[model samples]
Target: MNYMKNKRVTRKKEKHIKILYIIPSKTPTGPHIAILNMAIGISKNLKMKIFIITPKSFELNYKNYYEKLRESASIYEVSFKKQGILYWLSLAIKAFKLALSKHIDIIHTASLKILIPLGVICKLIPAKLILSLEGNPLYEMFEFSLFNRMIIILNWVIGMRLVDLILPCSKWLKSEMAQYPFLQDKLSFLHNPIDFERFQNAKPRGIRQEIGVPEKAPMILTVGRLHPVKDIETFLKAAEKTVKHHKNAWFVIVGDGPLRKNLENITKQLKISKHVVFTGFRHDVERFMAAADIYVMTSVYEPFGLVVAEAMAAGKPVIVTNVGGMPEIVGDAGLTVDARDVDALAEAMLKLLKDEELRRKLGEKARERIEKSFSAESVGERLVQIYGSLLKDERQ
Candidate 1:
């Protein structure tokens, strides 16, 4: 108890601004990738300190990458296994101590699960909570029980109230999330930035060459998890019709998930197995996006189609479902069709496949848009500016 009280006083003696990034998952996800890139992007900042909070053993799989990040930032590993109440309570205590010492300027949490706990920490400590809504929060509770759903909903409402900053990745999300009165006042825009370095370095070696896809044939590409919300079944149904006219066209999916087996079975049933390839979760996603002739996104509820933007950065023309923030990303640069409409998706694919001139024009426009808005350097500077503003605002 004395330690907790003195921890606050000790933090007051520090002058350097610090940020504590809280990410609960040990998986390679959008928020994980975003925070990593953000860390690397702002590495040269000598004044502002950044620390990443991740699950234990995260460094085991990503040693070099984490080491590189640690050059500019510190890492605090916590055991987040759903073992027991005491285990989590202990972890929280440790995190609180760390934040107290660092005089944490910001506590950035990507989802609601992290938000609820860390949001409390923000109130307890001299920190500002930045809650980034990574996806549809309600959709995440779809499989939960009625009681569990209610609990999460309450937490979300309270968490939004606690947070100092609420960033939705796109303007569409900003508008969509306005349903909640608390979120409406706190909301700000911060589109997920693509790692421009990775996109540029995607490869001189095409993914087609690696996967044995014919160099002369058109490659239709999709890069996302084989999840239900992704609505990949419609893409396959569209492929069933699109492949009839363009037999040389091959569809490549570069992700893995629970629905992989189901998607494979659907491909076989559609009788387009010969025309489809699944490259189950490659680290080199940008390489595949660059190698492809065109990119497609068919999500029913994409908060922001980060992959679609990456594909655009890769200078590939894209076709995306007109839902959520997909249209905001694609804008006038790519083709858009109704979500789950197999006929519309197939027609859009066919149109892009046939028009070489149209494809090149759109691809050029897409790349330009990415460089201007979604580039790594731009995102890094903008994030740092936001951080600076938040800290400065509080001091005032």
Candidate 2:
């Protein structure tokens, strides 16, 4: 008992900021990637200690990445089954105990579901609750399943009541939440940061030759999950039109999803298989982006297009749909087209392909915009300000 008391006293005196980061999984998906980057940045830039809290269902691969992260932080696994009242009750109990025992100063969640109960539980203990709203809760819920819609609404209500801070990835997302009167003053816009230096240093070499394209072939590249929202079918159909005129040009779609076979079948049916290459889930996206002449994003809805910013950072001209946050991210650096119009997309791709000077001008502008707003250092500074604001509020 005396030893335990002395340990608690020592911890309180040290007063290290203990942040418990909760995420759904450790996958290479969007939310996971964004949170992992933030955690790494914070660990390197600040003196605070971070503890990653993930569900037991999450796989523990990528030891190399985790080892680097663990050098300055710690990790814990908690089981959180997404079903039944009993499961939720158990999860709440476990999380509450972890927060209390670990002396967690901040409860930070990347997943939307954890925000409600986790925030409430922490607030009862008076721990700070910080939610990184990476995507739109309402839109993402409806996109996944109707069941999620109910959960999203419930969580949104509780989140507004309990969360101390809201971090949105884009202005569009912040505007969307502003429609809800409850979230007005609580919302803060912070776009996910990109390692601009790494992207800028990437060399565009050998990819055209390895992918079997002609040395001078202009390649249009789209890198993302092959989902319906991504509207890759539109890009593929547009490629059919593009290839009819630009015979030496090629369209490369990198990344994978449930729709791979469907997209492959469409390529065969369109008879443009020879002009298109579906390189499923290449880990070397930087290498692919380096080789590509143009980067395209046709997502019908994107909370924030990380890859679009990455492309601009790489000094590649971009073509994206004029929806969600794409236009804001691209600014005047790239072309925007109607999401569903095949001919329009085809025209933009072809226009950039033929106009080398136009591409160079756009690419230069794109890099400049990213340098001003989307660099990792800029994002880190914004986040630290948010954390300081929350800390100030708590003291008062």
Candidate 3:
């Protein structure tokens, strides 16, 4: 734990738990969204202060999309080199200075890359460190390349073990971490909180009509970054099958990433481009969900599909791949199908699209489940308890 280059507690005068959430990106990705929601809810309910440590370039988007949350929570735009050794050195120096100057009570990191430096710095000052695992890095590494695998191992060996708490979003992901003996006792499965009220109140009539899809069309929706891991190609193929019989059917994918061009090519090649609409990336995802009759997450693997919860909150019948923590999120409220099985995914989508009564019934059930289990209020309260306990223990 004492592997820091520099660390010191200058002014230990903060009244509340000062948590610094370290993350890589500030885009509208799930992890960033989760952190913002958690910060907003927790700040309102608990006497805690949060400082989000992110790149300076990310501030514009953060200000535009999350100004309200930022007003309540502090944001430290740290300048770091984009890559190589300088990035590591810059992050370490800035983190140490921020922690000491701000009298940060706890270092709560959400990115694996920063865990080592943060954990080591925490040990130098001997501050409590909490590491939240957002994705199964080992699986991602295996799915990617050897170099990535080494990075995953390094995180586990150096970062995960040193952290005081292991907050995993999914039990499935926690099980992956269980292989490490040091992390077993420190682990806690905390579901990512969703702002249900926002989605519940949002109406999508304008967005639906603007998208040019008939209001009566049985719209099937999926929202996430366009990537191979999302298995958008499979969803496009499944949409092809679904539209064959239901001519008024439509599939709306509402995000953009590297795989957009390839997925578009597949849609064109399948000759189903007319039935599928790629909205690139949109800020109004909840509205899109409201406009749709059914939601589907065809990810080959997802740590926890936050969009699935958002869809359920929007009161839309959902069909998600039975992968990662999605099955737990889906529970019995929505349908689950094997990932990569185009026929099965298509069948599930069609069933939801075709049955109006069933769709409504399932959507109602989905909303009930989210209200009971995944609301931001409930999640924030739980996190506050954990933070309080950790801070108390540190004081003792």
Candidate 4:
């Protein structure tokens, strides 16, 4: 089938398949980065073509991220006025036109908002639909009225079943999707890819020094949005308890969100303001990861924690709340605790901080886990195998 396959003439003619990645983020996020890594892997390993479609406006601001992406895949920009409704409609029309006019193998998309429309479009065409999930949007529906929740759930029940495959970043998330019996056959584990070597060779930017902490201070780092779901408050509470047991351990929360001020105030209320620091949304996240003693994730509902893997790749022991995919990612490699439990979080954090040998052993395992499972080279093989199988199945 034909979409946009990177073509190179080899002595043995290899089949080239076109895979179009639909990314909805105006800026780069976990899903967007994963697609780029997968595209690079596909291009390098399988001699296939990859295409990335994103909003035109945001692409202009983030040209640095897109430039390297062009080497592996072709980039397409569409109008995204009013959050891309018009673009989706036009994308459907264009995709359908391509379905009849050209050969396109797969249309991969993430998020429930884009899933319904694009899934409908893929259903109208021969292209296979690959649904990539970062987190379940339905989980947030608890705040909605039952009627509204039921309406959305029914829509999801229908939409999810139409996809050719559902790709969750971890097996834990795959298990959650299995609740819908129809999704069982369609589900697969596609862990997010990380730049293992980049972290392996990174030079620490002294994030702690920049934040006024001593160079020797044991730094506990949490990198995520300052949102309710991220549960930074729990992290702060745990940090408050941690300092009592291990003084000179500085907690740095490196992200910005609606809850930033609230989290900051909580740090003040907890009276650990001197011990806790908030560095709002640094682009240099890996630098902070390189500088920290341990990484922490306190998400109440994480589908797959990317930063946890990155920290592991940086050879830092991680402390993650045992929710969703965190357990799957951190199993045997890092410490885990129950969600919203400050005592457990603090105890786990303290264990890593005090035990240098244990921390090093866990860190080594963390990097090995990422290298074996979450690296681009490893995941590229999975993508190539999956794409080849899908094509072969279609032929039969």
For all predicted structures, in order, the TM-scores are 0.89, 0.85, 0.89, 0.88
Better of 2 and 4 by lDDT: 2
Error of 1 at 27 (Å): 0.9
Q: Whole-model lDDT, candidate 1?
A: 0.81
lDDT of 3 at 206: 88
Q: List runs of model 1 lying over 4 Å from the truth.
A: 1-15, 60-68, 79-91, 144-151, 204-206
- The order of the candidates by lDDT, greatest first, is 1, 3, 2, 4
- Cα TM-score of candidate 3: 0.89
Worst 10 residues of 4 by lDDT: 3-12
Worst 10 residues of 3 by lDDT: 3-12
Question: Model 1: per-residue lDDT, tens digit, 1-396?
Answer: 776576556555666668777656666788766666666667677766888877786686555358668677888887756624554566567668888776777887675654567778877776888877766577678866786677678777776688888778888888878877767778887878777766755773766877879988999999998899899999999999999999899999989999999999999999999899999987778778778889999999888888998899988999999898889878899999999999999999999999999999999999988878887667778888888787675554
Clashes of each: 0, 0, 0, 3
| TM-score computed on alpha carbons, candidate 4 | 0.88
TM-score of 2: 0.85
lDDT of each model, Cα atoms only? 0.81, 0.79, 0.80, 0.78
| Candidate 2 per-residue lDDT over residues 76-106, each given as its tens digit | 6656455456555666677788887777768
RMSD of each: 3.1, 4.0, 3.6, 4.3
